[model samples]
Target chain A: MVDLTHTLSPEFPFLPVEGKTFPFRSSPIATIKGDGVYANRWELTEHVGTHLDAPCHFAEGAMAIEAIPLETLFVPLAVVSIAERVATNPDTTLGAGDLMRWEKDHGEIPARAAVFLHTGWDVRTKEPGAFVNMDGAKTMRFPGFSDKAIEFLLGRRSISGIGIDTLSIDPGRDKEYAVHKELFRAGKWAVECVANLSRVPATGAFVFVAPVKVAGASGAPARIVAVW
Target chain B: MVDLTHTLSPEFPFLPVEGKTFPFRSSPIATIKGDGVYANRWELTEHVGTHLDAPCHFAEGAMAIEAIPLETLFVPLAVVSIAERVATNPDTTLGAGDLMRWEKDHGEIPARAAVFLHTGWDVRTKEPGAFVNMDGAKTMRFPGFSDKAIEFLLGRRSISGIGIDTLSIDPGRDKEYAVHKELFRAGKWAVECVANLSRVPATGAFVFVAPVKVAGASGAPARIVAVW
Candidate 1:
């Protein structure tokens, strides 16, 4: 089994917010000095660190994180590496052609499987500024799937969801978040900020995306693992 | 796969604290009506609802939630039902005798396997006061593993950890929290407030306790599931 989740901490960057960003605070709720026990309270956003974005994140009245089927959370994993391209162009978006090329080597992506885009961005997770990659104009930049790519994955392959090492399934520069809408509209979910994808084989790994079961919430932090 | 986690919400009871208790507050960070996206932020304790108790939760310099081994997180599950006793006497604790009886029916508890105690306490999870079951002196009463049972499991069987359907693995009335200390000192973990243990067979199921990967934190909320 390989852990495909980033350890959530205060340093893990949150998506740029206009008003109030989600907070991740950890304080000792009980300490050995006072309470004779050691425990903590974590107050954070549902989307902190490695997380799952349920359909409700984009589509109103859609299934929340709790409503996601247990069977769908565990699926065959298909990883497509685009690290080389992302190394040069941070705005690199995975296209349908990339999927076709990967299929040539890894066979067809099975139905109801999860497709993860490995841009090697997880290496920068420890450096919050680099992970977020905000430009001079304050616009973030990162790799994500193209709208056409997501549409193809949904319409042709019937995928359960898509995952990425970056903060979003859509490129940070995307103002409309087209990929998110396209995927969520198809009743699919997204797993973001996944770590250690390079350790997993391109095919044949079973991914477990276990999200904190927040009732009726749009999304929640998740612990993702892969077993072969 | 059976979901052994409860739906986390504001109504769910939190562990009583001297100053403040578990506060589950969720608000829309971005709404479709305003921001063209539906997202929310949540603030709560790491021990809220169904969660894993990392070794650091009790023992200093011990493994935090992120440091728990993946192999230990997934293991053979052994369910021991004491629902009848717990129904009549809420303070009933699982003792070494219970483990012996369970082994009598099934085989010996396997090494590094997770044992679950089903006390039928999940039925009260919806009722805040009933789940806490605080007496007149403000002492909470619930079923948990006794020190003898934990010692037997750790020393004799060399089990991975134990889980309970109550708010904690230690009976709420115990001030010393001896069970927690013993398990943590042995480098074992605990899954607390798990739901739907009755759905899983007494043996033969593989339990997955996937906690939110809070870096260096004592514990975190988990999504526990069992596959048969």
Candidate 2:
């Protein structure tokens, strides 16, 4: 089993929300010296670090994070590495051809499988600015899935969800976020800011995407893992 | 698959820490009416609702939430139901005899298994006062594991960790918190405030306890599920 989640801390980079930031505050509630127990109180955004985007995140009247089916949370993993393409162009988008190429190498992507786009973006976690990859024009740059790729997965392949190592499943600079719309329209969920995807096998890995069951919340932080 | 997690909300009952409360506030960052997306920002304690207690929660220099071994997070489920006993005495504690009774019915408690103490305390989640069970003297009433039971599990059975449907693995009134100390001394973890244990079978169920993976934090809110 490989942990595909980032250690959520104050330093972890979050998506550039206009009036929001990932606020993580921890203070000791109990200490070993004075009290027998040692514990902490943590306050942070539900979307901080590795997290899941429920269908409701992009589509109204869609399933909230808690409403996501347990069966869908555990599924076969299909990792498609786009590190080579992303190395040269940070804004590269993975299209349907990339999925087809991966399928050609390793059988069909089974229905209800959780497909992960591994762009090797996790290594930049230390450098928050680089990980966000914002340009002079204030547009973020990162690799993500294209509309055609998401459409194929949802319409044809019938995948459970899509996961990516980058911040979002849609390109960082995409103002429309068409990929999110297409995927969420089919009641699909997404796992974002995933870590250690390189260690997981492209096929046959069992992924567990466990999100905090926050009632009526659009999305919540999740602890994702894969085992082959 | 059974969801053993309580739905975290503002109304959910949290452990009473002096001058502390589980503050869960959510506001829509993006609304479908104005923006094309619907998302929210949440702020809450890592120990709120259902959560995992890392070794560092009691032992100094011990494993933090993020450092907990992935192998230890997923394991076989061993549940010992004490609903009847707990009904009569709110402060009832499961001892080695209870574990022996469970083993007698089923097989031995296997090594590296997640032993869960099912007290049916989750039924009171709706009644905050009853769920917390705070008395006139300011001591909370609840069912938990005794030191002997924890010792037996850790030394004899070599179990990975222990879980309970109550707010804490130690009785709420116990200022000493001996169960937590003993368990953490052996580098074992704990899952607290788990719900819906009645759905999970006593044996042959695979339990997945996934925490938020907060860095350097003693504990974190977790999503725990069991598959039979």
Candidate 3:
């Protein structure tokens, strides 16, 4: 099994909120001394860290974390390494053409398999600037699934979810979030901010994602793993 | 594949901290407007919700979350239902003898399998009084693994981790937390606050527990799943 969750430390980067200030700082919770043992406490948004997006997160009347079928959470997984492309162009966008090339190299994505796009964006996590990519315009820019890529994967192929190493499945500059809407509307899930996809196999592994059941909440931080 | 995680809503119970109450509110982060997205900021301690305990959680110089081998996290799993006993006594403390009785009823604890103790304690999650059980001098009293139980399970059986549906592996009244210390010291890991164990069978299932790669943190919350 390969762990694909990032450390939930304060130092881990957080997605920028366009308008309002983020409720909690991207920092570790405090460890309070109990009568004897210590208990940790901190502020966090459900969608931060390595997390899963339920259909309700982007579409109304859609499945919540609890409503997602357990079978869909763990399935055969394919980790297609897009690291070289991402390395060549940090702001690269993945379209259906790119996925086709990957499918040519890797076998077809089996039904209900988690198609993990390993872009090697996680290495930037060590460097704050690169990880967040907050250089020029107010918006951040990182590789993400283009509209056509998401359509081809969710509509054409039978996939349970999409897992990515970057902060979101959509490009940081995407204001409309069409890819996210389409995926969730299709009743599929997405795993965000996953780490160590580079360590997993290109095929034949099973991806296991378990999100906390936050009652009626849109989404929650989750720990995603891959087992052969 | 089964999702064994409880949703984190205002209704879900959390381990009450003694001090520093800045977080842990019903909704810590704001929901992203018009996007159906929720929470952009990161907050909370490594140990929150459905989570895992690395050896370092209690013992000094023990394995960190990342340092723990992958083989240990994804192993065969066995769920031993004790809901009958817990219904009679929420304070019931499971000992070595109890475990033996369970093994006699259900087959033996398989080698290298995670033994999930299902007490059905999660029903009280919405009731603070029943969930916390802070009634008498004991402050709290709920089903948990006894010291004797940990000793036998770790010393005799070839197991990877112990998972429980309760908030903590040890009973709420436990002062020394011997179970946590001994298990970690002995190189075993644990999963706490798991939900939906009833949805899984007693055997032929695999427990998928993955902790976040927090550099040197003692423990981190996990998204645990069971695959049959």
lDDT per residue for candidate 1 within A21-117, as digits (tens), equals 7547888778867777787777677777999999988898888999999999999999999999998999999999999999999999988899999
Please tell me what DockQ candidate 2 reaches.
Answer: 0.72
The order by descending lDDT is 1, 2, 3
Interface root mean square deviation for model 2, in Å? 1.7
At residue A63, candidate 3 shows an lDDT of: 83
List model 2 lDDT by residue over B1-228, tens digit each. 999999988888888786655555677677888877777767666678898998888898999888889999899999899999898999989989998989999989977899999999999998888889999999999989999998789878978899998889999899888899889889999999999998888899999999988888888889999988
Q: Chain B alone, TM-score of each model?
A: 0.98, 0.97, 0.89
For candidate 1, the TM-score is: 0.98
lDDT of 1 by residue, B120-160 (tens): 99989989899999999999999899999998898789788
Q: List the lowest-lDDT window of 10 residues for candidate 3 chain B.
A: B20-29
What residue pairs are clashing in model 3? A10-A27, A43-B43, A44-B43, A213-B6, A213-B7, A213-B8, A214-B7, A214-B8, B51-B221, B51-B222
Candidate 3: residue B121 Cα off by (Å): 2.4
* lDDT score, candidate 3, position B174: 76
Per residue, candidate 2 scores C-alpha lDDT tens digits across A76-186 of 999999999899999999999999999999999988899999999999988999999999999999999998898788778878899999988989999888888888889
Q: How close is every model to the real structure, measured as TM-score?
A: 0.98, 0.97, 0.86
Report lDDT (CA) for all predictions.
0.89, 0.88, 0.75
The local lDDT score (0 to 100) that residue B201 gets in candidate 3 is 93
Stretches off by above 4 angstroms in model 2 are none
